[model samples]
Target: MLPSCFRNICKNSVLPKKTFGGAFSKNNFATEATFETKPYRLHKLDTSPSTTVTINREDAIKFYTQMNTIRRIETAAGNLYKDKIIRGFCHLYSGQEAVAVGIKAALRPHDGVITAYRAHGWSYIMGVSPLGVLAELCGRQKGCAKGKGGSMHMYSDNFYGGNGIVGAQVPLGVGIALAARYKGTDGVCVALYGDGAANQGQVFEVYNMAKLWNLPCIFVCENNGYGMGTSSERAAASTNYYSRGDYIPGIWVDGMDVLAVRECFRFSVDYAGSGKGPLVIEAATYRYSGHSMSDPGTSYRTRDEIQEVRQTRDPITSFKEKIISANLVTADEIKKIDGEIRSQVDEATKQAKIDAEIGLDELPADVYSQSLEPKIRNVDPFKPLVHKRLGAAVNI
Candidate 1:
């Protein structure tokens, strides 16, 4: 048997190539309308005055809406989990909304993205409706995975999944990049894993392959300090995950700030699309929830520690403050967005709860092969005439 931590992952890895249903399902699969190849540059998000880029009100509103949608969706999921309306292992992307918003801001629809299990935020920004994701959490047939893949196996269009097995996505990401190169497309792949997964051997192996093949891949390490409650300092010998890529130019980014993430991802996208090979960007982010929903995050880390991060570096609040202070958005506008998000989440949760969940029959259907025939002991099975005659004379 596989290790318990990886058993579910192995099962999910075999999902059949079928279209997932739900609100986002209308355009979930690749069709004629996929994004066009566009060349762009990767620009590091720098706090330095010299590197600052001006943002207008319209752009600010768009990003803020995206971030708010992720936040509200996750908050709704958390409440649903608490209410027992959702089951199985649920990982909330509460604190890491900025990372998704920032990075997605730099990507087009054709670019590929894959992330770790804490992937609700990424899915939200990728145009996967809140109802679709919530339906998956509720195990409804209207889910992104057609009610099959609970929290850890979400997929849409070019978005691969919220893969559970740490570090496994690295090599797969390189393969996607290789395919893009072979097709002569300007597409890039953003492969993300957590700080805990950074220590996995497969990550390094893929890093080597990506460099050797000159794949247009951006390996993002969402180093949130703690790997399933273990502090990064204790888990990793070298805390600088960005520098882990010895062969590639690595960028260390402030992941708590959306602007910072956007700037860094933009730079990485541009650099990779320019055929400069793979780049590594380590976004030092944090997860507010326990490893899964089961572990209380406060047990290993102090409540005070969590509170400190919330008060000091909450990404959404920080961005809101900046926008308001810079007069890019007003309080009324922010409140309007917040209200819309709240309503959207509430509707999604209600719809998800009402949708029919998938059953055990779904398990066998998505696999690569099926059992050929049923065994019958009471009577002799029908034998082919040719097979019987040939076997009677020649028994191999």
Candidate 2:
């Protein structure tokens, strides 16, 4: 049997192969398709971001392809962790693909993005390749961070990367936004924290500061119901994380829906860039895995509950259905795309396993741009470690 952490997750998530027979070939795509989203619940505002989103065939293909790929990558990560290939603190973002993908869809390339430890999807969307991410997890030389930063610490351009500390990334995200604001650029920073971190004192403090300074930061609380071992109801005084901003405007979004997530981000970018200060967005999403790789995820929540979410609210499954029904692409095309992604993930996993680990001699590499001291002394002072600058600062 597979590890319980990966229970109910379909690695391929393949849409059943069917012969199109050229029935719907004529209308392979419409110029654009309009879909209504789940209504947004607004705080401190009268109007909401439009519930209607317009997506073209290209948009549909992009979202489905990216979302499915994220799901497959996470599933592969879970399997590697089970096989003990990827070790330590692996958080699978199997069900939260829509949130990151949707946000990216609505964001500018230069816009900053920072999130919690469950950030493989964010890293991929932020331009880290599947191979780079998997290699990083496997601690191989080809990793995005060159094998130094593991599951939680990969960084990319305009991406602050995932912070291991619960709420530490919030302030960093604000600073990224602050820098953009300082530079007078139109980019915004998206700082995402989990519901578990929602009650952090620093979150509220930064909210006040962000509002006071009117920084172009979009603070997001990814309320995935259960934080680590506890449910939101047990951990939080009020799960109304969006409304907790008080002074800052907040929007409650259905994170399971990619289009809805996109609209919320689009709304947030506009509002924040318009000198309206920061906005709080609560993405009501769910994670299939436990908080990290260690937990079974079944102890806090029932197997039945997890199964139900996979069947009903799964971001990838639902979006796949939506696009297929809308005729953006045929089911056969989807199955083929799924096959391609699976091959890519499998190949990446194989390469990651074969890639060499950084040697002990290079232990002190990539620590600093320039060091005053020639050697970093170890517990055994005689074997002083020499810091080697192998490559440029940015790995990905």
> Tens digit of lDDT per residue, candidate 2, span 129-233?
999999999999899988888999998888888789999999989999999999988889999999889989999999989999999999999878877888787
| Root-mean-square deviation (CA) per prediction | 12.8, 7.3
Model 1 quality (TM-score): 0.80
**Model 1: worst 10 consecutive residues (lDDT sum):** 32-41
> Can you give the TM-score per candidate against the true fold?
0.80, 0.87
Cα distance off (Å), candidate 2, residue 247: 0.3
Q: Name the regions of candidate 1 deviating beyond 4 angstroms.
A: 1-50, 359-396
TM-score of 2: 0.87
Query: For residues 1-396, could you state the per-residue lDDT of candidate 1 as single tens digits?
Result: 211112222232321122212222242322211111111112332322113444555677888888788878888888889999888888988888878888988997779998888878787778788999999888898888887788998888888888888788888888889888999999999999988999999999998999898899999888777788787777888867777888777876667767667766777788799898998887766777888889888777777666767886677887787666555567888999999889989999999989986654344344322445563221222321223555552212
Name the lDDT value of residue 12 in candidate 1: 28
Give me the candidate number with maximum TM-score: 2
